[model samples]
Every structure is written in C-alpha cells, then in structure tokens.
Target chain A: NAGLTDVREAVAGSLSAESGVKLSADHVVMVCGAAGGLNITLKALLDPDEEVIVFSPFFVEYLFYSDNHGGKTVIVPTHEDFSLNFNELRKALSPKTKAVIINSPNNPTGVVYSRAMLTELAEVLRQHTSDTGNPVYLISDDPYKKIVFDGVETPNIMELYENSIYITSHSKDLALPGERIGYVAVHPKCADAESLMSGLIFCNRVLGFVNAPALIQRAVKNVQDVSVDAEMYRKKRDFLYGELTRIGYSVVKPQGAFYLFPKSPIKDEVAFVQKLAEKKVLVVPGRGFGSPGYFRISYCVPDKVLEGSIHGFENAFSEAMK
Target chain B: NAGLTDVREAVAGSLSAESGVKLSADHVVMVCGAAGGLNITLKALLDPDEEVIVFSPFFVEYLFYSDNHGGKTVIVPTHEDFSLNFNELRKALSPKTKAVIINSPNNPTGVVYSRAMLTELAEVLRQHTSDTGNPVYLISDDPYKKIVFDGVETPNIMELYENSIYITSHSKDLALPGERIGYVAVHPKCADAESLMSGLIFCNRVLGFVNAPALIQRAVKNVQDVSVDAEMYRKKRDFLYGELTRIGYSVVKPQGAFYLFPKSPIKDEVAFVQKLAEKKVLVVPGRGFGSPGYFRISYCVPDKVLEGSIHGFENAFSEAMK
Candidate 1:
C-alpha cells in the first residue's frame, strides 16, 4: 500500500502517458518515501556483493540504503564542474554492477542530467547488460522532476533504458517531505518484470513501511498535477548564489531543486558548516554528501528566513576571510 | 518522517486522554504503526536474549516483533475460556524476563480483561520485578481500546501498571488502517524514563519510519475526538455469537472488539476454517492465534455481510457435524 497505492499508480500512469509511453499499474510499487522507494528497488535487485554505480556528490542516503540491502556502492565522481563523468562511470561499470543510480535535477549539485547524457547513460547500461550477460537497472531518483525552470523536457530514462525503474515522491514536488509517500515504477519492458514486482512488494513489507499512509496516497493522487512555486526557489537560488559568489565563495549554480552547493572558503566543509552555525545560518556539510570542500544551503525556507540570513552570511564571509 | 511529526503526537495525546491519561507531547513516540510502536518498545527495553512473556492466543506479530529484537517469547497458555491463567503465569516468570505483553479486547478472541484481572496481573508483574533485580516493563497492545460492548470498561493497563508502555493506533479506532499512524508512550513513572524516550526515538528512526506520515498525523490530530461506531461492531458480535451458539457451537461471548472466537464443533480448527471458506465465509484458524479447536471470525464487516452469512454458517456447521 505504501507509495504503490492505486492513486500513485494513477499519477505514474498519467505521467507516463504524458511522456508518450504506456504504463500499467502492475509496474508501480508504492513506497514509504523516496528512501523507501530506493530501498525497495535495491532490495529487489541486489544480492550480496552486487554493486550499484552512483554518481558522487550523490544523496548520501543511497549508500546507506544500498548497504542495508547488501549491495556495495561503486561511486563514479562527477567532473570538477559537476557534469556527467562518463569516463569515471565507464570505469565504475563491471560485471557485478547490478545498477546505476542517477539523480536528475540532482541533489547536492542540483545539475539536471541532460537528455543526451541520459541517452548515453542508458546506452552504456544496455551495452553493459548485453556484454556482462546480466541486466544493470537504471534507477532515476527524481524527487525534483517537476521543479526545473525554463520548461525544459526532462528525459524519461524508462523510455530510453529497457531496464529502468523510476523512484519519486511528492516530498519535493508537492512539498510534502514529511508525508512519507512515493512510488517505484519498473519499466514494463524491464527484464523479468513480474519478479521485480514481487520483490518490490516483499521489500515494502519487510522494510517496515507496511504501506504508505493511505489518505495521503489518495490526497497526493488528487494533487499530482499541482506543483510547488518554482519561481520562489529560483529567486532564493539566485539570491544565495549571487551573495555567496560575491563574497568570493566558489559554487555550482544549481539548475533545479532548492539547494545551492557552494564551495567552502575554509578547507574543512564541516568546520565551515560549524562556522555558519555560529553565524546562525544552519547548512549541511558536503562531506555528508561525499564531497568535501563544499556545503549546501537549502533554499526551501521561507523568503523572510533567507532574507534575514543575508546579513549573517555576509558578516560570516567577511569574518572568515579575516 | 514515519510518525515523529508533532501533529501525530498531538493526535496520540488527544486519544490517550480517552483513557483518562492526559498525554503531553513527550508521552507520544509517533510510530510506523502499532506494530512499529510494539517493536520499538521491545528494542528499547530488551537486550539480546532477553525474555518477554506472553499469554497464548496472542497476536502472531508479537512473536516476530519480539524475536526481531532478540527477545524470546515465553508462552503461558491461558485458561480454557481464553482468560488469564494466573496459576500458569505465576510459574512462567524468570529472572531473564524483561517485559510481559498484554492485549485487551484481545485479538482473535475479543475478550475484554476485567478490571480485577488487570489489577491482579499488575500485582503479579510488580511482585516479579521485586523478586528479580529489575522492574519488568508491561507492554500493552491496545489497538481495539475504543471498541467495547454493553458499556463495559476496558481497564487502561497504564493506569494499573506504572512501568507500562502503551502502544495504540488510529488504524482500528478511526478505521484508518492504511494510514500507518500510531504512538508508543512510556508512563512517566517508568524507570529510566529519559533513556526510554531516547531509545524509542532511536528505534523510530532506525526502523526507517523516520516519522509517521505527516498528513495523517495532522488528520488524526484534527479528528482525535472522532471514533468509529462501536455499536455497529457490538451488534455484529452479538448477531454472530448468537447464530453460532444457536447452532450448537460453544462460544465465549465477546465483550469488545470486532472479532468472535468460537470453539469449533470439530477438533481441527484448520478444517473448520476450510469448511467455512467453502461456504464463502472467511475465518482464521485458532492455531494461527496459538490455539486449536477454535476459530476467529472478524466481525468488522457491515451487518449485511454478517446477516447474509448466518445461513451459510448454519449450513457449514451442519455439514461439519455430518
């Protein structure tokens, strides 16, 4: 019942149709949250020592979730500019590689993986599966699917990869992180689709989200089309990015999601976060995201909170420089 | 967040007041569900190989929950009528016993423990604690707390036992089973109360509920005073009990909850369930509830479902006799 509820199926189905693909309810596995979705999918695909290739500076929970299910993480670090690192990715791929996890409108870096990049990634996975004599699933951690600006089309990985699974939630899109509702939809064309569905259901039960909260499953179904105000996030992103850069901090300009990953003026990102705490600006260290020398500022806070912190950031930056 | 949302605490607090216990925010540990609450309490209190005692004909999940946390269940069979067998209980206690699980308006049986029985049981727990080195925790599973019949009082175990942790949920009471919302509350007087709170919170997060579903937490908070109609359950129980008894079945009349456990006319309860199922009347075997020669009929269905099944039950009973 968790995220694979009837309503979630409807949402995923509608979304799939909009992308010009046919999807069925059998493909949907409701989950507790995006974490739940990830855990469930990993549980479905992983055997002991099976490896999942992750693009680093990834959402760190992926490591924990994968380990929880006995899978080893094969980290493929992105480039200096935080773009797709195909060279590193190709090196990471192996016969034991069971999956590759992609977070488009990525967390930490907030770089949306371009269509060409996604297509290439899918091609790699398809080729690797054929070459290795086993399937390597493509998992899209896509909580920020609808949060991108400029009306760019996000690549449907399920469309391009025959062995793709989509994991998403209303946590970011509908701004319901605490609701603990989301879904895992396997591409119907995925190899051994029925086994995947069974594994997902077992994972959902054993991982302890008996089902998603029922009413929210229905409530989210009603609001699947309703989206968060991306303009608000864009403004916050602009303000934070400009302010941090003006203060001589290096950072990737986030393309989607509500976070700015700015390089720390100090060598230790954790210490930098501690110093920001001293300035009463709470931010998470990039070390937690597997990328030191950077820290992330969540832009999801109300404008007033961010506006009030502008002075704090400026003063902290000046003091740190001193 | 699984069930850690403040709103879920508020709802749990409001509902705890139904038993005359005024719960503050600190009292509620929002959970994955009641199962999560029970498992959390066990994890908090039990060390590896610690023992938990339970009366037989208990909920099956108790076995898995206790074992999951390295607690062994010491089973003490109840009286022939499924009431507490005090004599058997007195012999079951050991130094390794960390807790005793009690369910009322009991599952699979629907027998509400009388106030005198609960008082006497509390005394037994107290005496056991005194005889042993540490106080034994009383774990009360009271999902059917609000469902009672003929204006009977279901003694609040928390009121009777100071060292009790009460695990209850809105699933049964509010008919919101899919919501996966519930709470675990430690009595203020429990030993090492603060540590217990920490353990519960730790368990909550470690179990991956992270917190309860947020909207249901808020929804329950809003409708804490509302309850499903117990009168309907009472009527169904009465009708089902009467029909079975009239057909020469020996049954203990259920005083609360939405189930009726009746002695089978045949020795094998499994066969009885199969016979009933043949008549298109589904019922669980008593063996599943830690007893044989008796079967449980969940009367949660509407009156029409019950009334329509009367002739069916009659026919099944007659055929079994033949």
Candidate 2:
C-alpha cells in the first residue's frame, strides 16, 4: 500500500534533487491523486473533532476531505493579496488544531507562497507547538508546483517545516489528472514520523486506494524529471490577465497556476458570475473557494476560446459596474 | 464523479446482458475497484453504528471497509457446505442492519451461491425489511464472479434482489488488480435508487476516489465481455483439490475462484498453518476469514509449485493429525 518501490525511489530522487534534502523511498506513499493523498493523510492524522486549519480562498474540497476523517476545517482568511496572514493564524491555532493545509501556486487564486512566506508560516506553527506542547502538521498540497509563471519556483515545504507532509500529483505538472497517480511524503524528521508513515500506509489500504494505477506508476517512474511546459499556461495567463484588466476588472496578477481570481465589479460574486454567464462568459464564484466579492477564471482553454471570451468579459464587467 | 459516460454505458450493457435485467448507464458508478465500490456503498447506506452483515469465511478487508463508513460488521457464519445459512441470517437481522455483503463465487471457500440460494437469501432480507420498515441493502461483491469452476455460471444477485448493489472489479477476471478498475451497478428497482446513486457519486468524491483511474476506464470499456479463461483456473483448482484430498486433508471441493478451504487436522488452524509453513507449503488460517478449524490454500500458482507442495502438505497433515 505504500507504493511501487521504484516509483517511490524515483519520486524520492526528484524531491531530494529539488529540495537539497536527503529523502528515501521509505518516506513516500503512492496514492490515487492529491485527493487520495489528502484523504489518507487526514485519516492518519485526525481523531474525532480535531481541527484542520485551511486558509480562505482555499480549494473547496479541503473541507470535505478533512471532514471525511472526522477533522473539522477551520478557515482562516488570507491577506488582500492572498499572502499568509500570520496574525490571523496565531489566533486560530489551538490544541485541537492538528494540521494546516497550504496550496502553493494555489488553486483558484494562483498565488504562490514564497520561501519567506513559508518560513514565517512554519515559525508560527513551531511557536504554537512549543506553547501548547502539541505538534501541528503542515500539509503542503503542491499539484501546481511545476506550473508556475514568471520563472518562479515554488518553495519546497519539507525544507521549511519539520512537521510537514508534502503532497503532490502529476495532474498539473504532467497534465495527467485523469490518470489518478500521486504520492504523499512525510518529512522524515517530523515527530513520530515513522508512526505517521505507518498510519498513512494503513489508511491507504483501508481507505480503498489499494495503490495508484500500476500502469501509470510504471509509466511515470522514468519521467520524474519531466513536466508540461508552464510557458504555454503562462501565455494563456498573460492574455486573460491583460484582457480582464483592460476590460475594467480588478484581478490579482497570478504568479502561478492557470487561474485569475478577479474581484467582481459587484460585491456578490455569484450575481456577477451569473451576469458573466449571461454574456456567455463562465467563471467560478470566489465564494466557491471561500472568498466573496471575487470570481475565478481558468485560462487553460484554447487560444481561440480565450480570445473569444474577451468581448463577453468586457460586456459583463461594463454591465455589472453600471 | 459518476464516471465516463461511455464506460458506464458499456458496463450497463454487459450487466444487462448477463442479468437479463434492463439497466441504464445511470445505474452505474465507476470506482477505483471492488474495494472502492464497497467503501462508497457503505458510506452512502450507513448511519453511524449501523450493522453490515457479512458471511464468515469472508474477505478480511470487509471489516475495515465497513468500519471506514461507521458501519459495524456483523459476521454470520455459513453452513457446513459454505452456503448461506438463512436461520443464522434471520437471527442476525435487526432494524440497524443496513446492508448484507455476499461474495460469490466466494473468496476463501470458493463456493458459488446458486440462484436458488440467493433467491432464498433475498426473501429473508425482504422479510426483515418489511418487518422493520427499514431497507436492508444487499451488497454483492463479485470480483470472483467470472472465475467459476466446473461449468458453474455465477448467478446475478441484482436479478434476485431488487435492493441489490453489484460491485465487481476486473482484478481477478481480467487479471487487472494492479490497474484498479471497477464499477458498482445499483439495481434499477432498488429502494431510493436514484438518491442512493447520488449518495454514491457524492461519496465517490468525498472519500477521495473522485473516479476510477480514467486510463483503465477507457481501456476496459471495450473489454467488458472479455474475461480470463475460467477453465485454466478450474484445472488448477482440480489439481490442488485432488492432491490435497488424496493426502487425507478434509477439504471442501471448491466450485469456483482459486481457493480450497480445507479442515485442518488440528483444531488450532494457526498451528496447523505454521506446520504447513515449516514444511514450506504456505496457506492462510481460516481465522483470517472469521472461521476457525480450517485453512485456505489459493491455487493460482504454477503447476510445478503445486506439484512440489504435495509432499509438504502430506507431511504437515500427518504431523498435525499425530
């Protein structure tokens, strides 16, 4: 249930090379996807009613995944620029807070947490642990780690936090979400890391993801160094970011991932999204990501589709603002 | 999260053809494997502390799968011949009995449930449901359905039970356990079948499967009618059954799958198993399947290995009896 050893070894090699930290195959558990990894991790770490703190504008599924294993989700709002708000986090941490989930090159928002940001976040967690005598885990969900724009490299969470569990999938990096292959790596230096690894392996089986698809495990074993061209997504991001801003929409310039989380011209993003939909422009309401007054546009579509949406976006923004 | 349309349609076609029941793509939900299907089914059907009945000499994983969804396992023993023991089943039924899981051709015992037996079993469940005004779902786990021996065609539980949910994987039949492809087919006439399907689809995502591996789903769509040749397994079953019986092992002749459940010469099947292992012939103690005084031999090995194990089996049996 841990995973194919060769695949784990390949992953370990890549993770070590990228982070400059030594990792062995024993640290990894193969999973169906980031989703599977998160579920198993929560199953292993959570007891009844334990709190898992997730930053606002988070992937919505984090709530469900935490709840699946009897963990309650405590949503803490990020800063206006979607950076870590350590003051809010400090107030949120409690003895019941078992883990904190961070998605870098995050879903919906596309804001990449830098090394400085992660280090500060790690310090907050360490301080909480020292004060409460309760260790809080940092779960880094990094499916979009390789999909960054502007030559930005997502920081390795393992290097910044000893009590970190790094989870990632080839979904965005390899553009293979449908293949359902990923791994969860426990930081070997974490408190009771060996016991945590055992719990992960046990949950992997009992949770019914016996192992990742064997075909993909073998297929990706040799391709650990390979990834989809982020430049292509970057091009799409540039066009959409530029067009949306030109059309009077206020959007944060995304650093990574193929999403533009633009403030709605109106306060109610769902109403604004409906207006966009009426103009034949579709986007997810920011409320779906636990943020209001904004909507998320995915720019991963074909060039023609992105180009075509320009007029619709302009009309929707003009009408909503009016 | 339900699954690829074409794949679900293909499975529906095969299930309809095999069961002589009209089924639509809507009735099917693709899952990671039989294991995934069972977890989701239990998740959808169970309330906390509800009971799930399993026939002992059962797949050991069923306990974990049931508990994964807050359902407790209530194991009712089978008859001496390993058929459904209705009297025991009747006594085991309660208002809290949410589901009963049956595997046939069985796992450890390899005893296929005849249609007459299933119809009778269905009747008992129906009676209990009517008495308590609570629906008792029949979950048929059929990974070994196509691996029957001696011209035995496994009966379709869906046709016999209106509230049945049929779950099977290509693991044993297509030799694709590593690929982890499977589907769950809800009986069209099942109580609240539509709601149950929605619950299943919801559980599919919340439980972290999202969907079965998409690559294998497409790969197996065209091969639903294809299965590994049963005669190959039948031959191996015959060889092992014949040899073990000739060596004075009191074994129930298996009718399906690749297992032989034989009575250990000593009441302590674990000790008997150890003696067999000492002789270099490995088998599982029946207590692993919630039955004692017996051991299970899986005969899916090469013929040479089977032949080589005869002396070991003979020595272990003689030593245990002495």
Candidate 3:
C-alpha cells in the first residue's frame, strides 16, 4: 500500500512538473479507477441542472455521470470524420456550462487534437470564461495517454488550461483494470485552488471512496515507470484495421487507444451491430456514444482472436452489402 | 468481470429471500460503498429542505453525506451513556422527514440497541411512514456487524423495518477495507421497488464504482462465513475498557465493535484529544461525532499496542484531572 501511493505521487508529481504545472500533494486524489476518478470529479463539480460540455462520440458514461449529479451535458459533436470541431464547440458554450471534457487519442474515434487545435480551444475557453464571468473547468480524461501507436503524440491539457484537472489510470497503460487504482491531479494554478482541492477531497470521501485501495495505491506507486505491453494491442489494431479496410469497410485508423471506430458499411449502426453479433463479433454500437452509423470495435483481445475474426469480418461485410 | 456480476447478483438474491420480513430484493441496490449508498438514498428520497433524522454520536460523515445531497440532518442526542433516547426521536420527527439512519452496535459509542429498543424504533418508523404519506427509509449502515464481542446478536434492520436498506462490506468484517468492496441490499418490499432499484443501479454506475473490484468480489464470495478474529478485538476492548475505567475515566462498556467511547475524565474533549495525541495516542474527539465531553479510542489495534497504551492512558487521565 505504501509503495503504490509513493509511485502514484511520484508519477503525478513528475507529470505536473514536466508540464511546468503546479499542484500541492492534496490536489492529487487517488481513486479506484479512471472510472472512479470521473465519477468523483463529476460529483464534486456538478450541481443540479448545471451543464458540462462533452465532445460528440464521447464515452456514453459521461452522459450518465453528468445526469446523476443533475448536470446537463452539452455535446459538441466532432466533424463527420471524427476530428475536433471548434466551430461547433463555440456554439455549445453558454454561461451555465461548467466544464469541457477533452479526450485525446480518445475512446471510439481515437482522434488526437493537434497542439494548434488545443491552443485555439484554450483561447476560446479563456474568452468564454471572461465573457460569462463563470470559469468553465477543463476535465482531461486521458486514460489512453500513453497507449499511442506509430509516431503519434498527445499533448497534456494542463499545459493548455491552467484550470485543467487531469484524470488517468493504469487500467489500460498497465493492464491493471482489475486492480482499480488511479489519481486526479488538479493544476495548482487553477482558479479557487483551495476550494477545488477541498471539493475534490470531500467528493472522494462522500462519493464512497475514502481513498484509493491502500495496497494497489502502493503497488502502482512501485511500478510507476513500468507499463503494460501495448505491442500486442498495437498488433491487434494493425491486423483488424488492415482486414476491415480490405473487406471494403470504412474506418478511421486508430492513432492510439485499443479501439476502432469504423463507419458501418450500412447506414443503420444498431442493425449493423446486431448482424455482427450474429457472426459472434461483440462490438458495442456507436449510437450509445451519440453517433449512429458508426460502431466501436475493442482491439484489446489477443492476436489469434483478431486473426481468426478476419473471415468473420469479411462475411459480415458481404452479408450487409447484399 | 464475471465474478463481479455474480457477486452483485448474489447480493441481489440475498435481498430478495423471504427473510419473513415485509421487504423483498426489490429494495436492495449495490453501491460504491455505504457512503455511496447514503448519498444516493438521500438524493433519491430527499427533496430540498426535507429533514433526515440521525441519532447523535452517529458517524460524523453522515452529516456531510446528508447535507451534500440537499437534506438537513436533525440530530437526536443519545442518552447520558450513549444509549437510545426514544422520546427525543419522537419529538424530532416532522412531516418533512425523509429518513432516519440507525447504526447499531454503534460507532464511537459501541452500545448496541437492544431488541426491545429496535422493535420500538420500528413501530416509530412504521407509524411515521403511515402518517406522512412519504415512506421513511431506514438506512442501516452495518460495516461493523461481525465485529461485535461476547454473545450479542446484531438486530437485522430488515426484520424490524419493511422499508430498511442495509449497506455493509467485508472491510471491517474481513479486514479488507483497502479492497473497496461492499453492497447495498435494499429490501424488495420497500415502496416503489422497481424505481428504487433503477435509481440505485444508476447511482452505482454514475458514482464511478462502475462495479466493485472484480477480483475482490470473487475473493469475498469465498469468505462470506469467514470473519476477523473477534477474540483479538475482544481482548483489546476488555484491556482498554478496564484500564480507562480503573484510571478514573467513565465509559460505557462496548457490547460490539472495536471502539471505546470513554467520557473525558475532563470535560474539554478537544483539549483532551490534543493532550492524548501529545502522548502518541490518537483518539478522535467526541465533538467530531456530535457529542461533547467524551471521546473515542479505537481498540482495533493489536493487543500489544493496547497494553502499551495502558500506562499512557493512565498518565493522560492523571494529567487531565490535574
């Protein structure tokens, strides 16, 4: 338990320092999982009927998390091909909007916003905060921070927004989802730093997580520098992406994270997912992520499974076309 | 993942069994922790400005939990010796009351409510619910159920109140708190059972527990009948209780659980707690628990530590009297 806390603190500290960010030890609230981190943050930040802005094709749980706390989620859906849509985001902003969530190398779509996009988003956020006189916090849900494939690099949000709070976990990076441990690091320079820290600590305790699991907190702290073998996931992503494109399926190549968000060969995603399940392919429908006609395929399975599913993918495509 | 779902279902099944009580499994909802259960219950059942009655010397977090969700807590102070005060409870209730929290084998003050008292309390709850139109939920937080001493039996809240929901964990019972595993078992007989379960499931997911730790859920299933060595706590409780009493400190003999709520040999509890800390004994002040002029000593530590603290307690008592 001791070791895990040390490792987590060290990693969080190193990350904050490397980005020239500032946060006291108290601002770092460790949790059971990134999912826990998300829940805790929402619990602390949201009050009834307040709004949190999430980009489109976002994780479905974001909607649930926000709604549970009586917060409305304003979705600024990304461009049709799944890139950041700043024009749409500007339209989504309002005085009641409490926060904006950015997931880079994100879930489903797997698009990484360039630094230029982030710089512009920050400028817009600053202007919005000034205009509304209500600061809109940035929640960077970056569980896939280090799961990049090829040569893609994801920028840290703390560098872009002083009010940013980063939530990440080792579920993907260390393959420790079963372990359920992670932390929330708030940049010390954020507005109302003390209130923010207290809200987070109170949220952590009141939300039913007094602290992270003592033993796993120490375990992750011990193996802070160590990471999961993502090579296997990278290989699975490559194999599936290759086979789907070959079979005439349209997909945006996964830049990072172990998921493929491929446009359905047919326009109806729910029906497409049902047909795929018939072929024993258990992909989650993208309609759940707020986008129809696209579906998410998790590539976290083994290499042999991906290789074996190639023929199944081809068959699903043929049946759909006919 | 499979084990977690099974454990959840098992907990659900436990709630549904005909305990010969009025409630069925419909009342039970799996939660992140008892804390999560408390907040969700408060959120679901409470309307703005509604009152929640809590027995004083209750868990301090109860106040924070209730307030955060928009309910006000009406504290009914316990008797001089920290036993139930039924008259006070009768006076405290109003039509706006949402629920009452009863922690038997109570924390800080380890006085277990007698069966007679519990039955009387049940009658109070039933009458209040009938008269109010809004059913008053009885939330029994039971992390210390198996941590009692002697031949005492902890009364089942489900047996007493048809509207009761029990939240418990292996944390204290199995000494697995760092594991963050627990359940919320609602009696299915509660009013609006289906909606309650739906709210609970949403609360569990939205609160960020997603589900309990999958592996620990499996591990706990194997140890349902296993318990922490009660004799160890019994011995320590006896030693500390005896030593404090002999040293001129008055205390209610603990019937269950591992805490000794000793009356401050002196009246100033904050000062007393600070002085004890000076002597390297860490006891929370009674003021923290909504009762002054008394403080708590956690007897959960090893016997050797309790033995070593005997002289410390003696010296502290002597110094306080001066």
Candidate 4:
C-alpha cells in the first residue's frame, strides 16, 4: 500500500519521454506534487546550515521547503528580464552550497531557462565542485513543463547536469492542482544517485508523506496523455500581458506558465496591490516572492474573471501613476 | 488545494462524539493517515533527543516516528498480560520525557487498555508535570478504533489527559488503507492547543503531505457514518483463537482488532515464525514489536484461507513444543 507499482513505473516512463531524461523505475519517486517532490529531495540532501541557492522571486515556497529541513536558503536576485544572472549565481556558490533549485517556465515571471543557460550553470557547478570538492546538485522543478508559449523549449536539465533532479507534477499540465501528485526523477549520472534515491524514499516516509496518494497515482496513469487547454491559458496570458504593457506598465512577455510579473506603477508593490484590490483586482505583491516593487498577476482563472479584471488593472495603474 | 473545509471540522465532530472529547474545528488537522499524523505531531512537539515513551510490543512504527524527528524512543516492557505497567512508565518519565505514544486495540497483542489504566497513567503524568513543570503529551494512535470485538471500549486518551493528541486513520474502519486519509485532533484543554494545531497544519504542508488526499477527504465525509464489519472479524478471531488454544498453544482471547498473539512454544519466536512460513502460514514475530517469544497472526484474509491455514498453525505449534 506504500505505492502502486504500475503507476510508479508509468510516471517514470511518462517523465522519460516528456523530459528526454532517461530514467529507470528505481529513479522515479512518486510524490504529492512538485512541492512534495522538492521538499523530499531537500530533506534527503540537506544537513543543518547547508546552503540551497535559489533565485529571488522564486516560488516563495522553496524557502519554506529548505528551512523546514534545516537548510539555509541563499537567494540571488534575477536580472530585469528574469534570466539567470550566472555571474551573481557564481558569486553565491561556496563550499556550503549543497544544491541550486530552479523553476523553469517559472511561476511568477513565466521565464523559461533555455538549454544554453542550463548547460552554462552545469559547467559552473562542475568547475566549483572540481575546485572545492563540494558537489552542488541542480534541482529542476517543472510543474508547467507543458505550459510553454511561443514554442519555448524547457531543457532537460539532467542532460546538461549529471547531478540534476527533475521534480514535477501534473497539477499545471492536467489541471489537477488539488490532486497533489508528482514524482522525483534522480539523474542516473548524478553522484551517489542510488544513495540519493534511497534517502529520498526514506525521507518520503519519515517526513510523513508515507507515499503519494494511492488513487491519484492510479488516476495519473490512466490520464497521463490527457492535455489541458494550454492554448486557453496562452490566450489569457497574451491578453493580460498586452494590457499591462499597453498602458506603460513595464512587464516581461511570459514565455510559459500562466503568470506575468509587471513592475508596479509605484515603488511600493504592497501599496500598489492594495490600490488594485480597491478596484477588485487581486495581484500578489512581489514581496511575497522576495522581490518588491513588482506585482504578480495569475491568468489561470476563468476567462470572464480575466476579462473583468482588465478594468481593475487599468484603473489601479492609472491611479498609481497619478 | 490545501484541505477540504468540512473534512477537518467533520473529523473533529466525529472524534468528539466517538471519544466523548470536546473539540472544535480548529482542534482537528486532517492528514494522509495515522502515519502522517504521527510524524507531523512528533515533528512539532519533539526537539532533538527528547524522549517519547512507548510500551514494548507496541506498534513498531512508533519508534521510527520518534527517530524521524530526532527524538529518542524509550521502550518500556509491558506487563505479562500486555497491559501498561504504570510503575515502569513512571520510572521511564524524566525531565526529558516529551510524549507517551500508545495504541489501543493494540497492533500486535490486541490488548485494549481499559479506562482505569488510562486514568492512572494520566494521573501519573499530571503528578510528573506538576513536579517537573513539563507537560507529557499522550499520543493515542487509534487506526483500529472501530475494529474492537466483544464490545470493548477504546479509551479516548484526550479524556484522560489534557495534553493528549489523538492520531488516527479510517483505513481499518473504512477498509481504505490504500487511500491514506486520517487526521490529528489536538486536545482542546491542552496547554498551547492553538499553537499545537497551527504547528500540525504547518507540519502537514512543510513535511510534504501538503494536505490529506483531497478525494479521500471528500469520500471520508460521505462514508464517515458507514459501519465496520466487526462481526466478520470477530468470527475469524474466535475461530483462529480457538484452533490455536485447542492445539495446546497459549493464546490470549483478543478483545479487539483483527490480530491474535500466541506465545511461541519455542523461546525463539523468529524461528517459530519461520517454521510457520515454511508451511505457507504467514505470521509476524512479536520480536519486531519488542516482545520476543510470541508471534502475531492476522485474520484479515478470507475465511477460506484461515480454514486452510489451520493445519499449518497446528503443525508449527506442535513441532515447536517437541
């Protein structure tokens, strides 16, 4: 009853094909979600005061996950374009650095890191490990793996970094956020991959997950191929992104996922979000993601809701400008 | 996505009525199962090296649960009848004593602790708390609460102690072990009950459970009032107990749960279990639960299997006696 056998292998097969990252059944650890997978992986890898480097304005939960397992999270601010600032990332690395967690088709900004960026990061990690003898793992979370727009390619990070872990769920892909089902794929070439897999399974139990939900595991296998209407989300993103940029709100074009981050019209994102709330617009302050002076708008809602919120966004922006 | 609103409140109400404990919605925290609830509660309440006292021949997972959260599990041997020895328990308690985890309709022995024993233990705890100024939480895991035979009453430890935390799963009662749905109910009268409830919910998320399975949570509410087939199990228990005792085996008449524990005619219970396995009769050695010279037989299978296995149990017991 720990986990259904076919579903675990099914998840492995599904991920190997979807990710282009070769994996065996032993490599796939089914989890509650990307959140579940990430936390389990972190618990397995981290000791007290161990450093996990995460980019700022990252999914805020990453910090919570690390801290929950006694790992210290080191946050590096991203560039204005929301690309990996490798120079800053390199400066953040040290002997204490245990892993770097990256979310592609990222949550708030929807900025997908290309293969080139990943390969460069891998190279940086390899050099540092060679110099300091402290290996740093690359943990890639891709809940929005299938939600890319404009034909963006999300690199199989495992292919670039031998010490990579691919964590994801079908929450975004299958429109099943409430299900909380996902997996952790340990890279075959990762250092001590077998040991890492064992630790992950042990942590999965001791950390109280015991295993991923049984029914959802079975359900996932049956509907692994069922695709959500990503185009609908794409349409929503395009409309919302256009509206923000059209009114002189500086916002990056989202490459994937269903969220767009725009610079607040005022310096105080909290105050600006409050101003928007007054217009019945609900945007999260960037401070929630450790990046203030910006606001996040999620388009993963009803079309009518998105349509109705347009006026709120415009009104809030105009009022902030005044 | 976090939890079903009604499920937590429903669990609180259900347990309150069943156990005669006073609990509100805030007192109940839904979890994946007793395993999930236990681990989260341990993580919240235990600091490194704190002691959680468990009676020997207890549920084996209790040790693992304590160790998972850096707590030391101190095992106290049970009385010959598998009852709690208050004297031994009193000796086990110290300034470092944090919790006492007990399972009634016990896992291996199936000895349901009476209300009197629970009250005595509660008084011991109250005196210890008064003298040492440290609260000792009584953690009662009641997965088999509804499985008791012969009309035995499973004491609600919350009614016995203010600091009690009841951890349970509906797997046994609802026959839904595969679903992994359960909850933790913080005692309303407990000191820091509010903080404990908050810690439990936080631990549920950060420990990678996120929440109990959403579908199971909903399903539990619908079938919460469904009756368990206690008679079917009682019939199996009676037959199994009769056959073993008739064959000159020393077996206790199990008052609850689906298991029967019989003293091995041989001092080596592990070897006795192995002998039974040789005849294709599966039984677990009590050594696994910290009580050697005994083995646990589960009557959870069909009656046909139980009938067919009678020869194996008799043959093994006779051989061990020789």
TM-score (0 to 1) of chain B, per candidate?
A: 0.94, 0.98, 0.93, 0.97
Where is model 4 more than 4 Å wrong at Cα? Answer: none
User: What order do you get sorting by lDDT, best first?
Assistant: 2, 4, 1, 3
The order by descending TM-score is 2, 4, 3, 1
List model 3 lDDT by residue over A1-322, tens digit each: 1114455568667676657676546667788778778877877787779999998899988987787566898988888768888889889999888889888888988777778888888899999999989988999999888788787767788888887888888888888766667888887788887787787777778766777766667667766667776677677888888889999988988778889999988999889888888888889888899998899988787777777778778888999999
Name the docking class for model 4: medium
Q: For residue B244, what is the lDDT in candidate 3?
A: 81
Worst 10 residues of 1 chain A by lDDT: A1-10
RMSD of each: 3.6, 1.0, 3.6, 2.3
| Higher-ranked by TM-score: 1 or 2 | 2
Task: Evaluate fnat for each of the predicted models and list the values in order.
Answer: 0.38, 0.67, 0.61, 0.50
User: Candidate 1, which segments miss by more than 4 Å at Cα?
Assistant: A2-9, A18-21, A42-55, A63-76, A84-100, A123-135, A202-208, B1-23, B39-55, B63-76, B85-100, B119-136, B202-207, B222-226
Question: Candidates' lDDT values, in order?
Answer: 0.81, 0.91, 0.79, 0.85
TM-score of chain A, every prediction, order shown:
0.95, 0.99, 0.95, 0.96
- Candidate 2: residue pairs that collide: none
Quote the lDDT for B201 in model 3.
70
lDDT by residue for model 4 (B59-114), tens: 78788788767899999988888899988998999999999998888998878999
| Best candidate (score: lDDT) | 2
Candidate 2 chain B lowest-lDDT run of ten: B146-155
Relative to the true structure, candidate 1 reaches a TM of 0.87
lDDT of 3 at B74: 97
Error of 1 at A104 (Å): 2.4
**Tens digit per residue, CA lDDT, model 2, B178-254:** 88889999999999999999999999998889888888999999999998998988888888888888888888887
Model 3 CA deviation exceeding 4 Å by range: A1-5, A13-27, A46-50, A127-135, A264-268, A275-280, A302-322, B1-32, B40-51, B94-96, B265-268, B275-281, B302-322
lDDT of 4: 0.85
